[model samples]
Target: MAGRGDIGVRIGLSAVIFVLDGPGLSVLTTHAQEVAPGLPFGPFDPTRHRTFELALRAFVTAQTGFRLGFVEQLYTFGDAGRDTPRAAPAGDPARQVSVGYLALTRDALAPPSADARWRPVESFFPWEARRAGRLPLIDEFLAPRLRAWADAEPGERRRRRVEALFALEDDAGWNEAAVLDRYELLYEAGLVAEAARDRPEPPAADDAPLLGQPMESDHRRILATGLGRLRSKLRYRPVLFDLAPETFTLSQLQAAAEAVSGLRLHKQNFRRGVERTGLVAPLGRTTTGTGGRPAELFTARLGAPEDGHAPGLALPALR
Candidate 1:
């Protein structure tokens, strides 16, 4: 058996790509391409690469033409059968490990072609609600399986799993930061495409849609990892500023936060949070109202840590 140290760590990158929201807070995308045809998996070229970060930047730019901004390491995925078989001579029975990263970019960048798409984040993770609505996707698909899993074992063990996974029993509330837990739950229930090959047949419609779009190999899972990181990071850190334009009205900044987080915010409360955080400095300018009164504009306070020290923004709080 291969020891833990013997595992091969292949340096690879995946972008949890996002774009600016339009009027009424609509999500957009610039680079939307299929993984296989655009980026084929092969040997990690050492000579042509200087560092992993540089290689990721180069790969994304070369493949989709979108320049990346505000990128951070998301997670590392390594499972025995995760990677597709390598080409003939390169065939090695070693597991492939991928280092995922999250990236934010402006929609000004055009995606390569039709094979790639920049659909809203809702298209995939429908459970992430931006409006004041319940996630039917979860109620319809995930809840049942989670209940089953919770009920599998009795006593404290079972109770804990249920509470941790579903936030049930005590109205403990859903912890949005548990992104990986949510994905893994869906995977174990065979609701996601990543584990499709392992199962004999397709799951019922209730479970089918929960998986969202299937990416090449485990790319979708990697993408999910990145998405989870981005969502949680927004709360404690000022990373959202990276996605905003230079000067933006308070409402525009809130919209940007909602677009990325997939949840709405209370207008007054959001303004208060921004003010308390002191992350945005007033621009001393105002813009005419979209329908009501004009609003003041501000820019994200720079020179502080990339990770800001604010009351982490939450999707539910905003809603």
Candidate 2:
């Protein structure tokens, strides 16, 4: 008989591959017919793969046909109920744990398989992207519902949390790095589909407010975790190069940053910030077909310096 320590624990691997697709940050996804799309995921077979990262890379490449670069381990999601429709197949161990990884690329390739796709990141959390000035869903649907949820609590805890995470009230400010926090809060308040998926009685359509499109199982939550981590890391690291082409104009670089953060950055201020970091050098090449004026091309420095300075300028305070 197997001992307690010998219980089979299924090891799964998932990848949240971020690409700077046209006008936005996109994620590589796979669909299991009739179910929501999810990150490229597969089981980790120790016999076939030497390491967790290698296993994840293999699975994602097999699913999306796009090789990943600049990969990093994001987090481990082992919650008991996280394995949804894709729960271990018959005769497999009942226990499961998934190791999540983050990968960045400059291009979103056409999927080799019919079920794979490159989806816009904002589709999973529409409220996170601010490119369209202001999203009506947040103002007309999310705010009122969140306020009601906060007020229902007898103590000040939930209310304060709502204010902090969503930047409610006059003085509170939005924190771009709070992506996961905001998503989890919405889930707790029963405003997202995943929360309803787990509940015995799902909320009415009016109550759930179609928070973007849902992913299969808890994959959306894992994507949120990756986004939050990447947002926070951008402040201290020169990791954005992983998502940039070998050569690009300053305007192009700034646009990439804006797309990832979902905020418009002041052109002059952003350029100044980039200059101060000394992270890019002239490539001695220029593009003349911009239709306005010739633009100089630049390449990212070989290494990201850690000088204890806040990266790029923070968004101008929101009014």
Candidate 3:
């Protein structure tokens, strides 16, 4: 066993895989020792793999029986001491540095393993979802606690952050890309389960401060980073098509965008915006499977020059 004097770094890859699940978006999660499930992850073996992505794909398949497609490197999580529990053994003295990636799938396929399953993203980050309507949890549960925490001394700075990231007041609007920022703020305020675990003098878990679930080590943080990256990409790239069927109704397309953004869209406005982009074209067919009215089917112009040059889908959020 290495002593405390022995310092080392281990390279790990965490997969934040997202898939469209009906009207909601879900992430692929697996578990081992943590109270909550975490992203599919494994160590990067320099000797066994030629590239980091190959190693990530290999272990994810090994753990969940799922394969990865296009993935973007989201961030490098090298924060000292934040991942001590999962870095190695209890006192192995080696730090864990994870390279996180974001992946999107057309469907939420089953993982074929009990340990791995599709869990809705909103379940882990309840306050972020706004598709159904206003989240009562925000006003009734989270906001009150956050306000009290901010009201405590050093108030102004804290209060302003709370208002901005969460849109606590009408003057501010929630930034979908601030997912990790919000979580980190909650951590500092000792309002999250992770705070209790990480801070010696933090508000105890008994406080039960609207704990939005906790995953092992820094997995939840990595998940938030991926979510924020994807949400930001929506404004400039039509990458949502990667999570959509080859042919889909405009409504279905809009639903996919809404699921990822965690916001509702004005129906006609969204369709008009998508049509203007020229990223998708009518299939000359219809899908009555939509259950209500027969909706026109359209396929994405994936390789068209116009598509490659086009901007993202237009999302006019309903105020």
Candidate 4:
């Protein structure tokens, strides 16, 4: 619904480049104008680029100085009732649609540029990391606040949504891949800093919980999309190998899986299942780096033995 002078559509590109290393799980982010960080982002130049993927790769490399590999389109985000405070309001009246891509790498590297660096995924979405079992943030802090937020509204659906998203009825029912759902719920309830940034008016209550670290613009939403996509992709695609070392011990592989999935996997079940799938083969050598008895080293065999089609691993959670 443009009156007369709307610039119409503006296309931008962003990357959610993730890596697993000593820091556990982390994503590459460039310094944003505000205190928060943002995904590598730039406008898509249709004149210079033939494809969206190429444009994404070009800017991500320019901003982070690290070329991307094993990337996939995540989702497109539109500007609607979102506050991009330091944004280019100059276009004064143009809608921006950012196409986000998920990039996975085996190692974390120092971005050749000073503006970009790797930040732990937990720093922004700490609640998503549940591999260690119960989180006090969920039980003691997040639940009560979210329950209050739901109750303040005039609908039973809100309460039901809270119960479903948080799995308050059954702790074991929590879905790790629903990162976007949970984050969107939090944003809707004004329990996060981004909520405050977006809303022009003051918060409904002074005590509204400001949970998790914030990101510039809607980059966090894009990140939640990437995280959720990665979690879900693990079930049917061998994308985890893109984020694994060239060679690693079975223990290391399990640890990487646990880090990404945010679930404490059952050791015996995980090992048996992985071995059964023929997704990995032992190197006939052992590594003492695990700080215990020698553990056998293994390499990822991305393709299945039968059809050469790679399938994702099954996570045997320690329920």
Q: Give the number of the best model, judged by TM-score.
A: 4
Off by over 4 Å in 1: 1-10, 23-43, 85-94, 112-115, 153-159, 167-170, 200-210, 305-319
- Compared to the true structure, candidate 1 yields what TM-score? 0.79
In Å, residue 314's CA in model 3 sits off its true spot by 1.9
lDDT per residue, candidate 1, 1-319, as tens digits? 7686684545455556666646322222222333332122233457888776777777666655556676676777676666552221356545666666667765544466443445555555566553554566566566676677667667676556556765544445666556666666667766666667556675555624445654556765665676777778888777777777888898888888877766656878888878877788998888886566888878877564555434455443531
Please report, as a residue range, the 10-residue window in candidate 2 with the lowest summed lDDT.
310-319
- Per residue, candidate 4 scores C-alpha lDDT tens digits across 206-265 of 554577779988999999999999999988787878888989987888898998998899
Model 1 scores what on Cα lDDT?
0.61
Model 3 lDDT tens row, 216-286: 88888999999999999888888998998888999889989999999988999998888888789898989
Whole-model Cα lDDT of every candidate shown, in order? 0.61, 0.80, 0.84, 0.84
Report the number of backbone clashes for model 2: 0
Q: RMSD of model 3, in Å?
A: 2.5
Candidate 4: regions farther than 4 A off: 1-3, 84-91, 170-172, 205-209, 304-308
Clashing pairs in 4: none
209: Cα error in model 1, Å? 4.5
Query: Any runs in candidate 2 off by more than 4 Å, and if so which?
Result: 1-7, 85-87, 90-93, 204-208, 304-319
lDDT (C-alpha) at residue 71 in model 2: 92
- For candidate 3, give the lDDT of residue 67: 89
Clashes of each: 7, 0, 0, 0
List pairs with backbone clashes in candidate 2.
Answer: none
